[model samples]
Target: MLNEEKILAILRLQKCKAVGDILAKKLIVHVGDVVQIFREKTSHLSKINGIGKHVLKHLFTKENITLAQQELRYIQDNAISYSYFLEDKYPQNLQHCVDSPILLFEDGAIDFSNKKIISIVGTRNMSSYGRDFCTKLITDLAPHNPIIVSGFAYGVDICAHKVAVQNNLQTIAVLAHGFEQIYPKVHKKYMQQVNENGGFLTEFWHNEMPLRENFLKRNRIVAGISNATIIIESAEKGGSLVTADIANSYDKDVFAVPGRTTDLYSKGCNNLIKNNSAFLLNSAKEIVNMLNWDLKATPKIIQKQLFLDLNENEQKIHDFLHDKGKQILDVISLECNIPMYKLASILLQMELKGVSKPLPGKMFELI
Candidate 1:
């Protein structure tokens, strides 16, 4: 639980009209603390990059302070649970997102300790085939016990939630509106089950209605909270595609279930696969393999290599892989401070030298 003062400051910054999540984060980083952002002088704050006249003007407005205080009271009176972005309770995957909400309000018993989170989304008018694929996909993934994250909308999102519940897996519903109300109204029936199983997460304030833009804003949360996003079905223009695009932008894995070319709902998914925006999803196994979910069950013990001819960067990578065992290619690049383009060639050179080998799913290990 966040201290009341900290949550109040976050709320104040969040309610600032001109400051978005990115700008809010910038301010926090420059100010060194959320509470200090309010205490700092306007002229001093103006010196920070991205803090413009508009931001300075609305940042500490009395109205926003009043609103934050009211919302803080609402949170206290309602006993609502929330996570600050800087806190451990915030989902780790989401914490890495640059634009993730600074203050996320959560309801229900949500456990993000299990990091294997998958997001499933699609059109509201899901076909029978889409329904079947959605059901079977979550069912097969039950053994993996990944948290199922989805929009709490009609069709694919609801199906994913219900199927996850049936399989005894935790399911999270990212709501576009506040907890005061549920969109589509019909989903209210499933709230208790979802609450008991997983929970609903949102950044909206209490009493906020489900507006069109809110759903678009909510998509980022859905895409950000999971390791991968799977599209069960979608039309040419749909929110599911938007979510997939967001996930891709985040450099997260995206999967699209293919259907007949003529199928209207599959067009968006087909285009995604064709354009290489997403991988061709056949079953849960592809997700499990691509994400290396099953590899965690058995740890690989890599032997430290003896003296070998290697460059400084190559040796750094080799020592890293040797210490960590099998690691994803992106992780290697990040940990070793090598760019992806350079890392690929270096790994290939290492492969030729017989110092390392490539594994399934872009993974590398010391040979």
Candidate 2:
């Protein structure tokens, strides 16, 4: 659970008209703490490279603060669960996305413990061929035990999710709106089942509507949270193509199932492969090979790195890892008294600096 003050600070940033996730992260990193961003003087904050008059005018405004307080109260009273982008609990793969939401509201039990997560998305208007192929792809991949991710919409998104549930695989639904309501209305029937199997995730606040723009924004979460994104079937234009493009931009693997030259739904995917944007997927075996699911999972070992300087947070983490040989993320955050969110970023930076090694399942140690 996120603490009240920190949650409120983050909420305030969210409400700030001029501030978005990327800029909010800049403010927090510059201020050293989320709570401190509000306490900071306007003069000092103005000096940050991205900080400007419009941002200063909107940030900490009375309206924004009041709105943030109201949302904070809602989270507390409802016992809402969420993930801070900087925190260990946030999807590990998504932490690398610069524009990822700073906070996400979560529902039910979504587990990232099984890191084999793949997103399958495509046309809402599905053909029998697409449905059959999607069902088989998921059923075949079930043994590898990947968590399926999708929009929880009609056709392919719903198909991937239902098949995953049938296979008893954990699945995640990235929502375009808040928890208060479900989009397309019909999928509401599957909510309890999804929550039982995995759960739903959204960056939207309570009661926010599913606007057209929201779905486009929601595509990023679906794209970023997964190890790879697969397009089941698509026409010349669609949202799934946008998701595939986003995945490619992140340098993550993207797979497109091929179809006949004359097939209407295959155009977008064929173009993706033809343009070298995605790999031409032949079978589930290829997916398993590409992601190395067939390989055994183990921690990476490296010799102790020497002669590196660390910032205050990095030093604290280094000291903890130096004493504890191979510690999981949660233990280090507690031992170092650093928030899991901030600790995650610091650990990644340390890894890049060659001062630490990261293991599967959020474990870390000195190199």
What CA RMSD would you report for each candidate? 6.5, 5.2
User: What residue runs in model 1 are displaced by over 4 Å at the alpha carbon?
Assistant: 296-367
- How does model 2 score by TM-score? 0.85
lDDT of 1 by residue, 169-234 (tens): 999999999889889899899999999999999999998999999999999999989999999899
Best by lDDT: 1
Query: TM-scores for all candidates?
Result: 0.82, 0.85
> Candidate 2: which stretches are off by over 4 Å?
305-367
Error of 2 at 30 (Å): 0.6
* Model 2 accuracy (lDDT, Cα): 0.87
The Cα error of candidate 2 at residue 62, in Å, is: 1.3
